[model samples]
Target: MTTSEIWQPPSEFAEQCRELYGLTCPPRWGTPRRPEYPSLGPKAWKVMERLGFPPMPWQRYVLDVALEIDPATGLFAYREVGLSVSRQQGKTQQILGVQVHRAMAWARQNIVYAAQTRGMARQRWEDEFLATLDDSSLAGKYRARKSNGHEAIIWRKTRSKMGITANTEKAGHGPPLDLGVIDEAFAHEDDRLEQAFSPAMLTRPMGQLWWASAGGTDKSAWLNKKRAAGREIVERLWAEGVHPRIAYFEWFAPDDLPRDDPATWRMCLPALGFTVTEATIRAELEKLDPGEFDRAYLNRTRKSTPPQDPNVPVAAWQGLADPVSQAGPELAFAVEVSQDRAWSSIALAAAREDGRVHLELVDRRPGTDWVIPAVVRLRELWDPVAVAVAASGSPSASLIDGLIAAGVTAPEDKERPRRGDLVVMRSGDLVEACGQMADAINQGTAVHRDQAELTAAVSGARTRPSGDAWTLDRRRSLADVGPFYAVTLARWALVSRAEAGRDDYDPLDSVY
Candidate 1:
């Protein structure tokens, strides 16, 4: 059978297939020749249509993959089915339809629907499954237990029940489940819940586990790992015509695509224009932060982990942009070099008359050679109070020789000290500077003129613990957060000088 012989697909779905990325399966139209086996997909589709829940072509295609039978055993080939697509693309409706079929067609197919929270799982039960049952001919044939202690839908004829459970190790412990629908699988960080539930399905020969979710962060280790495993198997299926027992279906945009681009959004969202409108998506995007919109709607995962609580929120950094480029009399400079020594950045902080700290990324260049010359030139022009350097094992250590060559001197005696033009900050002092930067942002005292590089660094910055204290985790950050560190150090120098009440602060006499 050819696509022309099949019914015309919905315009939105057709568009989605055209732009799809992260593919690792036999695409709907490109399913290769395989062994003869009876498929329940068409039967399921007909049942859904009879119940007035006619599925889209893409939905039907996913059903085919999930329902594919093994030629040898006359049962489903795949024991696990994973569907990862954007929200508002009718995933809930599809899952509800599949469960309904199992409840009606199969005898005693005990199923469980699980979500991140019990309330969410219960809500989906009442809203979609129950609503569909009520509308269909199966209404009076089933008994509903909607209470807290007893939440299930029991088919009066077959005595099979579809239960709801939260994503916890204790959930669905006693029940012998034939099918488990894991809703919001992206929210799961580990497989403890799945491990707990697996015992229920172990004895059943036809047991199936279905996972449906939008893309989540790298913190969702279990889902990400499963997806990767499924992808590897699917790739083999596409290449060698050998199908694995795990059915994985994913619809997402390429990583290089811009989140705001309509093409990227269209690729991930199969129900666009029908269930979700562009205007609604744009409005919701306006309300969300950088990664939130992409994660929820675009089905794009964050490539790396960010700290649980960041030193500065991306929104606060975005809010503190002040367009003034003027530098006040009190100026300080800070330099940051990437741990890999591939890049370095110079930042300047000025104490404005309004008592606000103005920050800017003065320069960023490859290698450490240009860094010293750039710093020296900036110092000569601005006559800064101090050039601060975080004496980390990497960047600061390498900068010591460069500073000496630039004629910037550091104090030899730390015990009885006056600050020199070069301030070599180490240990607790560097951590204090990080905290001070966060304070300035929270108090609305820190301002910037808004450079793209600086904004990205601020958004990507995450923290790591140094004993009881925390410092920026540059390695975990998606990009170099050097600009953020540099500016924070510069801000500390100016604020510390002011706090000491040193009016005639010699470049070499102020305390660090």
Candidate 2:
């Protein structure tokens, strides 16, 4: 299509954040009148097909994102859908087009491109931003402009401007940001990295625009916290209360990607659309040496095996409930801590039929500080029942003492054998204990509160290099407890009072 053939350009439009975001706002900056383009329907699709995209949700989502203009709200409406796809996908074109559209249609508007690193961030403008200008109606928006590498594109217009920068823990200040794009966001740490930079974009009266990458593996901190926060945010905004509108786009291994067929690769990346073909599939399968591909692509996380023997195959554990609804004394619980700073697990195996055990609940939490509170709570409810806690180190020991003093547990003077023991290690015991426990769980003896994390750890755990074994990826699974956490609970519960008070056992923390 000729330049003149393209949609008409407003005599003087601006890229202020409000218009770009499609929000209703008083135009205090940039051009005033709300700019109009054909709804991102037929025409956008025609070009996308020409550009090699199949009719996938991403393409449709991209159009919807482009058509949406709400700087006052719903920057999320754009960000959520745009950033969840692969590297060569069309999002790069989408951001570049949006920036150009804003610059051409709005005046004195600020646009900044950001990435985790400065060099990577600059590449957006060089590859996508500049290329779109070369092919579009935007090439003539400025009489004087410079291709400022990846840093930015500067317009000489006294009325409107566009730029780019990488977001740092420090803000990318100097100009009021109307539009911002974050590339490969899954790589960004979750710990409020965006929060520090986001506020700066809203400095403009029109508000700000944001789009980022899918999250990554930084579990204990970043995305892990955000995953929790995202849940709360969604519940608050969409479920119970009202907050700003937010959006989420996720593409990952499905819950059912079978571990049996390590090559069950097709199940995970369904968003591949027209990109994944028979040839592509065959080639990827061919390239990978079985084990590496399974862990890397399938996301199979390995358990943190004990140093002596990691593969200690754990037998099944089951959770058997009492036939009679209400029975037994107040129950005592024992929890174990893993050596990894990132993981510690607590198990609550309760009394059942004749000498057999059932795990009422289990949690593979992270860190000692995390382990203590739950222990303290369990100790409180089962007061007279001595709490058998793993006495790993000073942190763990202090918590035990703290519990006794704080009335969460029976006094120390009353301590006895079955009540608590470090469950001191025997070289072969770790695996044996895990096997015994796994047997209890598999046969319905032990049950987990949130099976997602526990099952993820169990299934993900696998064989590693020779002599060394699969240790849980604390970075990935919460169930990274070296053998201490899972086994300790079982050992503690087996010796508790069956005839004494065990009725008030609360299964709150262990069950979803």
Candidate 3:
């Protein structure tokens, strides 16, 4: 009847037990009290107890939020945890609680917590997580292990550490992370996404990820893409097939809430602890326009919001595309180079399923370190994907020349199409592409990451008066569209390349 006896018990006895009881309960418990776990359990629990596996107050809520216990392992069994509560739900505090427990309670356990903003590194530790460390009592168990401007953390006696970081490549880079908890994950980059979670999933320890956010759209963000991919994995795993270490949980509404119901708004928030009370919710409620509230609160987005340029009135041209689908050559990417901006863009312009180009992709770069690198990226990364990009400017022209010098095929030059050439208009290309892109999105044809900069840029880009008319500018541009700069230059460069029959040129002439 005991575990030792059960194993030594005859095969006939085991078969009889299985046939008699649906459960695995035997004479091991109730009959006797054994101090140690039955032989079947692994040695990890001893390490877990030493490292800090059992969670505390706020973290208990998170564990309960994702409460699927793995019976076989006696551990919380979830591949991913996604929290979409409104702001100030002690968001970072909840993460800190669990992170500390995971590190202190488990050995070789790695935890990385990141947020979208620059100052979040300290805010999470000093303002949210490490506040517990300073309380004197918790400090006895854990000590503030380290701090740079980028991060600070406490080391548990068990040898596990929590690394706090802001949302940037430098912070998210190369580490053997076991648990990755990202705040405002919608702000992460699409390409650099590997830095965020790849290390965790690929490791033998196999880290789980937690993606938490308030609300945003895929106007232009890497996190937008990540969250989208996360959603797809969660929503369509059965159809998409199984992923080994990926699980997703998003708790939110289908879209914007109804103005008629105050209770419904209260229910959308996860901070049921009265911190985000009815009074605060109402105050926030009073400040929101119906549209903004709908987008921000309900996790919905409006694709065709007007760009900054008032002259570029909401073009009737673009339509919304699918969120989880793809179309061919509907968008062309244009990249731009600058010595000023810290980043470059690869604009994914719009095209349609109906054989018309609608959207554009632009990848931009700032001066210095990004110049040659951006050009190299354009050459290798784009090619077959983008229809074309502007290959003008000193940097771009030389980049193209160097490629030709190294033996590359340049897109054949087309004569500069003037404004009168409405049939083949460049601005028309943008407008038409954007229109189709919008249509594609509305119709469910494209995929984008939900993010602040991209959403703000797209929604904020508008026409402003220049001379007698208006044009898209920064407070009104969709983004500092480096891709547009690249594509636009490429358009002109091809033409100039044909006329000059030379390998080098730089024409900064969007206007004569």
Candidate 4:
């Protein structure tokens, strides 16, 4: 066909443009919009507009498909709808419009909106939903109940109510829900919310369930399962020409696409031209890790695999254990905190006369309150060459000010940290520390005291990308990695001081 002829039809013209320039990626799998099907989407859009929230093009498209009515039954065609899109795409606003429409159009309807936690749900309901409603023309139409546990928005005439709840097994249990929404479904690890809410909608003929989120990691088992099922259903429909009562829409960049290209972003992010700008995405790309940026912005799920070799080999780590390992006169001490701040660890490193590093776990305890006092006591006794902390982008960063307040002196000049000055390590420094520690263990240049805490930390250590190198990923580690980090920092500080020709220590200067 001629180019001019192809451009004659609107759909054909759009398809040609898309094929040539890679403009947009439609839902990867879902029910296609049928013009013949009547929908309440327009009314929902009108409601949103009246409340000063206009639907974006993508939102309008989703609403039309998700709210399509069955001609025979005069009810919603889809019983369950799943929407997976990148963050900041206005999913909440679209869902809010739908909720408002359902509440106003139907009599005595029960609508429940849930988030990952009860506090988050309550906050969103109050800050976003109710705040918008109260500020708009719709304020006079409903009465809000702001009680701690009994929060609801009740329509004056219809008596239809919308409530907020946590994504627990008990969510939507008491009410026969007309609509149930689970926001940020990626946080859910299982199908507890589905099991609880799906049954509640069975009796209501017009009931619908909605799940919306950005793409998640392998830990998001429930969302992953739902996405897989949605893909399968779409494939089945394409082959057999059959329709199902489930609707799934996904806007995700294909695995093969170049992530850095703006064209690729346009294909995946529906709000690129409307709400979000390319400049904003570019800034985010530079700031966030590759895996995190993909999940948050490209709507790409992370499929984690078991590492062929652990970050630290268990056998190598175990073999380097020494029951009576002790530090010499020249010493460096380091502190680290668990990812959740539930625990903290202090480690000591010393250069032995035998040309080996002596590593020991000084102290590990629950809570952060004791860290400052413990560090102070250790400093007075050991007179160490350096006091190290992996502070940047870590929970341990919370201790920096407290350490300073307790008379712990940090280096005025980072390039040359004086003896007994705190060596605050950034991301790059931490990466170097991890590499140095790994090499020392593998080369038999380091010996540890074989403490259980140290062993557990080494065994469970995981790595995350930091620029060109990697560092310990406390979030993904199976066990508390504070001890491991602490020792790594300690060794790094000792090595750094020696390499810089600044390890001038005296045993007589020790306070103890």
Cα RMSDs of all predictions?
Answer: 10.6, 14.4, 19.0, 19.3
- The per-model lDDT (C-alpha) reads 0.74, 0.44, 0.44, 0.82
lDDT of 1 at 370: 85
Per-model TM-score on C-alpha atoms: 0.58, 0.47, 0.45, 0.57
Candidate achieving the largest TM-score: 1
Could you give me the TM-score of model 1 versus the true structure? Answer: 0.58
Query: What stretches of model 3 exceed 4 Å from their correct place?
Result: 1-76, 146-151, 170-175, 191-193, 237-244, 288-292, 302-304, 307-512
Residues 127-170 of candidate 2 have per-residue lDDT tens digits of 76666555554455454344453244555553555565655665
Error of 2 at 200 (Å): 2.6
Clashes of each: 0, 56, 89, 0
Of candidates 3 and 2, the better by TM-score: 2
- The C-alpha local distance difference test score for the whole of candidate 2 amounts to 0.44
| Candidate 4 C-alpha lDDT tens digits along 120-210 | 9999999999998988889899999999989999999899999988777887889788899998988999999889898999999999999
Give the C-alpha lDDT of model 4. Answer: 0.82
